[model samples]
Structures are given as C-alpha cells and as structure tokens.
Target: MTGQGSEGTFCLVLHSHLPWLAHHGAWPVGEEWLYQAWAHSYLPVVDLLRRFADEGREDVLTLGVTPVLAAQLDDPYCLRGLHDWLGNWQLRAHGAARGLPDLAAREHRASRWALEEFETRWRHGFSPLLRSLVDSRVVELLGGPAAHPFQPLLDERLRAFALRTGLDDTQRRIGTRPEGIWAPECAYAPGMEAGYAAAGVRRFVVDGPSLRGQTWAGRTVGDSDVVCFGRDLEVSYRVWSPKVGYPGDPAYRDFHTYDHPSGLKPSRVTGVHVDPRDKKPYDPDLAAAAVRRHAEDFVDVVVARLRSLRERHGRALVVAAYDTELYGHWWHEGPAWLEAVLRALPEAGVRVTTLRGAVEAGHVAGPVEIPPSSWGAGKDWHTWHGPQVSDIVHGNAEVQRELLELDLSGPVRDPVADQAVREALLSLSSDWAFMVTKDSAADYARYRAKVHADRFAELAALCRTGRGSTGRGHERAAELRRVDGPFGHLDARSL
Candidate 1:
C-alpha cells in the first residue's frame, strides 16, 4: 500500500469545522448549534468509524478536526450539553414510536440506535476516535489552525503559528502527529505554502480551480515539497453543486423548513412556501432508503471515473472532499449516506483511501504553482473577506494589528494584555463576517465585532498607559483583560 503508483486510489477528505461555538448563543444560533451537530453528525460519524474498525475493515478516512471545534467538543460544558441533547433524541424516538405504524416503529428504533451510539461510543472525549483510527491504521489524522483563520487575511507569520499550534494540539490529543491538514474552508492564498511545509504537513487539500493550467489530481504547491491535492470537480459537484445536486433532491428532507406544526419534519423541499413550524415528522426509513440509492449512484460515478483515468494514465486517483457538516447537519441523511458509501465502495472495486495514503504511494504525478483562490463563490475570497464582508473584515484586521503591535515581543507578563489578545483573536474569525453577509446571524455578528474591537482598544491603552482607559473601546478591552486575564506567555516579536 505504501509503494508508488495509483491504481484505484480514491481519497475522501472530510473538513470538520464549527466556529468557536462555545458560550456564543443558542436557539436558532449559538452553543446549542454545536451540540445539535454533535448529536446529529459528529457522534454518528465517529460511531461509523468505530463500527468499521470493529468489523476489522481498514477503510481509511482522512479527517480534519479544527482546534477551535475540538476544544468545544472536549469541553466539560459541551460534554454535558451533548448528553442532554441525546436525551432529547430519545424523547423524539418515543414520540415517533407512539401512535405510529410498524414501519414508523422501525424508524423510531433506528433513531434509538443512533442516540445510543452517541451515548456509548462518543461519551468519552472525541480524541479517542482519532486515536483508535490512527492506531488501527484505518485513518491518517489531519489538523489545522486553532481558530481556523483565513490565512491570507492574517499576517503571514501567524499562519505558521496557527498551523503549528493546530498540529501540536492534535498530537497532544491523539498521541501522534498528523501529516496532512485541511486548510480552513479549503481556503488558499499566495505564500501560504511555506507555513504548511514548516509544520511538517507534506500534503493538504485545495479546491479544483487551483489547477487551472494543469491536470487535476495531487500536485505540488510552489517550490515546496508539500503535495497539494486538487479536488476533483466532477466527483465533488455531484453531491454538492449549488444548482442541481443530491442535496436539492425533492425527496430529501428540507433544510430550510422547520416542523413547527407537527414538531417533526414531514415535507419535501418545495423551494417555496416552506415555513419552519409547518414541517412534518422526520421519517428515518425514507431517508435511509434514499441514502442507499445515492451511495450506489455515487459509487457508480467513481467507478466510471477511475476506469477512465486508468485508461489515460495506466492508473489514476480521484479525491473527493466535503465539509463534515454537510452530512448529518445539512443533508440530515448524510451520515447514513456516508456509511452506505463506505460499506459499498470496496465491494464495487473502488478503494477508499486518505490523502496521506495517496501521497505515500507517490500518486502525485507532478509539481505545479497554485494560484490564490478559495472555494467561495467564483472560487474567490468573497465568502470570508470579500466586498460584502470587507467592512467587518477590515475592522477585525485593524484590531488584530493593534493587539499584535502592543509590545507583545514576549509573553505579556501582564494578565490584561494576554486576555485582550485572546479575546481579539477569537473575534477575528471570518465566520462572523460570513454570518452577517449571509444573514445567518447579523446581530450576533455586530456584537462580536464590537466586543472584540472594544476589548482590543482597552488592552492597547493598558499596555501603554499602565492604566485602563476611559474610552468605550478602551474600557471594554480593559475589563476583558481583568476577567479573561492574558494570552499566557505569548510573544508578539514574530508578528
């Protein structure tokens, strides 16, 4: 398996990320957002991997767990919240089981199975899942920046720190260093290659457009030895295109509709007249059947592509990547679809492999310089820092600069400086801008930006004047420093 040459090699990289959701907010948005995904996606996905391993099947999966999300997943508060959320799942199962047909009863049973799996398999911290997969040689873990910053928007030097910090965090948890990483949002910008090479990451995933002038597949970035795997557009768009994709299928559960009427989802995506409260009950059986069909169809596409590639290159590889949340969170049936796909792949002659496995086998054909691009609309940075998000992004960048410039050459020694920097960086995440532009949580976006900006002001004043300032931003930053303390021996000299 380690030898060179690609013969039926397919890498599936799932990018798992959720903004620093801890203690943010809840109901329609916030921390519960984290728990809901935990109950629905993360837990089940972990269970799937465990089940595969227990069955003695080494189905390699390359997974990227961002540090910010990992911190929440392992936090005490998140743990408790997840337990309560699963209990709610049990409640939903009871509701489905009562006054229901036999088929419905079976669906309810499946729901119970999912809930139980969350409780039993993922009751412990998530690190165990990564550990089991790496130890059993079924997965090659990938890691990236702690808070998942958009690298180009950040100072160049911080990029390395973020990558190294993320890798270190993963090693501490899984007891093995990761050789691969998923750049946040599949985001790439010019000059970020050196950061990857410095972190010992030999391979990372990029979007399809990065290979504009060259053939798609695994290619090198710039002068670095770090291999860059370009996502296969034909395969990826099949499941997640904006226009016509599996998620848009009428039979699938409606992501926009919330079942306020029946307290359960019971309608197809009509693309109109869909109110959250009026949806129907969630029917797992119907969804599961759909998953099986989709899984088979997907495998068919991969098989055909693999054959075509072999004919041209004598052997070929295809890499299909997707956001981890796309499964159980967005598609609802995603986890089942994934499980079915994994189970069906080998039988269909398509081998499931990780990015590391492909590169380890020398599947990379050549080196190429990747242009600056993101997987956002038009394959640009608009989603994170474009025109719509520029105002807040600039606001954030300005504050970050102020905090970084405050004589942080060495650990802030002063608790106030540390807290101010910590708060500022967390607020610097691109997610707030996205939420504002997408109207997902506009008010929350405003609150986060103001809070961070104010906190940064206060910290800067304290560092210079040795006393908390009276201005609104300055005072706020000072109070935050008092409460959160400091950045903990952080040195700003590198910046």
Candidate 2:
C-alpha cells in the first residue's frame, strides 16, 4: 500500500552525531570538529528545512540528534566557543585573500554568511531552532543513547539506563520524545528490540546486509513490535561509495592539502595523485554545475530504483541513510546537492517521507529475525571489536565492572560515584575504538579514552575508600563535574 501521493515512498535518514568534545582540545581535533559541523552541516540543513517549511512542505526527512550531541549544542561553553570560532574563520578568510584571491573570496563570503546566520538564528541555542522544526511537523527527530555508545556491547542494565536517560534528555530539550532512533553505528544485538520497546522507540534503521539485501519495507524485529528499517545501499552508494562518490569529482574543493601560507584549501581534486601545488584552482561555477549534474543523476537513480521496487513489491519503502556531516562538512558541495535532491525527488514523482511517515503510510512488513550486526567496515561488529581494538574493548569492560561494583546505596551519597559513572560512559564511546582502527585521529581518540578511564579509576578509588564526600576525593569529583557536567541530573542511585 503506497502513500496516496506517489507510487513508492523514500525516506532520507541523516544521523547527526559527535562524541562529547567540550573542554577538550580546540584546534585540529576537539571543539573544532563541533564548530565545523555546526557551521557547515547543521546551519545549512536547518536553513533548507526552514525554506521548505515556508513553502508548506512537511515530512521532509528523519534527523537523528543524539543526546550527547544535544547536550553539547545546548551548553553555554560551546555556544560561546562557536561564536568565537566563526569569527576566527572570517579572519582566516580575510588573510587568505592576499595570496589566493579566487579561493579567498569564496571562503570570505561563506564565513561571513555563516557568522551572520549563527548570530541571528543560532546565537541563543540550537533548541529554539530545532524545536521550531519539530513543532512544524516538517521532520521526524530520532533519539539515541547518551554518549552514543555501541549499545550491543553494553551491560543490559547500563543499556536500559542509557536509552531511558537519552530519551528523557531529548524530551526535555526538544519538547517531544522521539518515536524512532538512529542506533549508534546502526549496530544491533539480538535482544536490543526489547530494550528499544521499553524506551518507547518504535523503529530504527539497520544496514542492508543485516536484512539479507531485501530492504524494501520495515520489518518487525523477531517477536517484538519495534520495526527495523534496512537501508537501501544500492541507492545510498550511488551518492557516496568507497570507490567513486560525487565528492571526489575534480571540480569540488579538495578536503586535504591546505595552502601553507593561508591555511586555506585553494586547489581542486584535479587528479587523484597530483601534488597540491600543481592542482587546478577551485572555481565555484564549475563546482555549482557539478552539484546540479550530480543532483539530477541522484534523482534519476532514486526514481528508477523506486519504480523497480514498486514493480516487485507492489508498494515498497526505500530508505537512504547517511551521516549528516557529509552534506557540507566533508564534501563541501554536499549541502547544495542535498537541497537539489530534496527538491528534485518529489518533482520526479517520488514521495520523500520520514521513517515514521512511511510506517504511518502502511509501508511495513511482517516480523524478521535480526541477527547481531553493525554498519561497520565489514557490515559486522569487527570495526569496534576487532583485534586492533581489543585493548580498548578490554579497558571498557574493566571500567564497567568497577563502576557497577561500586555501592551507591549507602546513607552518605558519594558524589564521586556519579562522576565515575559519567567518566565511564564517556570512556565507553565507540569513536575511540573506531578511530584507532581507522587510523584517523587515532592519537586523539586514544588520549580521550585514556583520560576518561583514568578519571574513572581515580573516582572509583575514592568511592571504594568511602572518603568520596570529603578531602581530595571531594575536590577531584568537583573538578570532574566542572569538566563533564552535561548530565548533572544523572543520579548514580538509579544505576
């Protein structure tokens, strides 16, 4: 049964997430990651949605904002830091204009526009802007576990607590509880459906291989009623694949190989092996033409895929899931391509709906037994639990064991216990292991993991001594609170 407006339904799922990075390093790694994504991806995407809303469009797409990300976006420290980062970006653009006029002009324009947008709309916090979209019913927001943990590997009790707390945080901030979630790394274990059900999550996305390549409709997981939607890799890979994605086009701005004089990338990906100094200069008009070309190509592919699926399944649902940061942050031309695609899809007779909208439109199937899986490198859990990351895995397990063993049921509540739990959760983030395995930012990832683990160890020792509420233990706990205070409402007693 297809929705009344189209032959088939297409759901675009953008998972927006990053690990907690506040008060950490700033340049090259930590808060810079947050600011860059905010300026490039979040701002432009929100603008596109608002433009659609002004034209009376609804059910645009599914957006997953993890609680950890939300906490950072809403934090006062991050807000101030973002404001300053945008200013610095503008300064760099101006400095680049002396040597590279063409590239510097474009960068200057972008920086100024981003600064104006941030100051006018996002100056206060992301909540007001995000809440407006939710209130308008233009997008279905998906929530996930706090800290973006790989839930399949977590302890059962901790898993439940994280899910519930994440939902609670989203509700408090977004003014609505999410009905769906973008599970961290799209990872799944056999019994997670029950935990999702308990947390009031009605549906989630999984990798296509997890469903054995038959990803036409959302399937109920095992005996539970929670629906699992498998991504259509065929369509998604057309836009972004390992071998050839639109971002690698010669006309697009080069992501690597920055100019030494100005620290701005002035070259194009003229040739895969060409030296940065020998590459062709970037031209906005050339990239714009490519964006339109690629957008049309993507629309054509989606339409053809939907028609084929419709012929086979009568009424099929095609879900294309992607990392939200890919749009403008990674690809540079991504946001433009996205805007073009969203506008072109409906015009091409494909109904662009959110995951929840697809379900409500009757595009669902019977239950299927989902195996333990993740959307990792090999379409399995190896990226996170592989031999290369075995040390991280073992460290995580030891920390969890100690944190759980701590007794917080006594009369005098040990504040360090709460801090230890916070540190433990932060340490358990899957980014560390993934980064180590990928060798991208491996050192920073390992440093972050070790820092949290050490903090947890210090606090755990204080808790064991029963001196957590006074002396050096109290000072350390207070310091930790200052460092990791996003979940002030978190109570160790509940754990």
What range of 10 consecutive residues in model 2 has the weakest lDDT sum? 1-10
lDDT by residue (1-495, candidate 2, tens digit) is 334447578899999999989998987989999998998899899999888878888999998998889888889899999999888888888898877787778888998999899889987888888898888888999999888888988999989888887888899997899999999999999989999998899999999999998899999998999999999999999888767788999999898878877777787888788988799988889999999999999888887888898899897678999999998888898989998998888777788999989999898897898888988888999989999988899998998888888887766556788788889889999899999999989899989999999999998888888778778888889998887876666778878
Using all chains and alpha carbons, the TM-scores for the candidates as numbered come to 0.87, 0.97
Model 1, 1-495: lDDT tens digits are 222222387878888888766665677778777877776678778777878888886646888888777767766667778778666655665565545444345446656776677667666778777798889877677788756777778886566666666677777778888888888767888768787887788888888887872333588778888888888888888898866678766567786664342234455564445565554545556666777788889988887887787788776788888888888778878888888888677777766778877777667866687777877667878878767777788787788677656775544344455556566666777678778877888888768777767766766677677563336545555555443332233433434
TM-score of candidate 1 versus the correct structure, residues matched by position? 0.87
Query: Per-model C-alpha lDDT, please?
Result: 0.71, 0.88
Local error of candidate 1 at residue 472 (angstroms) = 17
Assess candidate 2 and give its lDDT: 0.88
Model 1, stretches more than 4 Å misplaced?
1-7, 92-115, 213-216, 261-263, 270-285, 409-414, 467-495
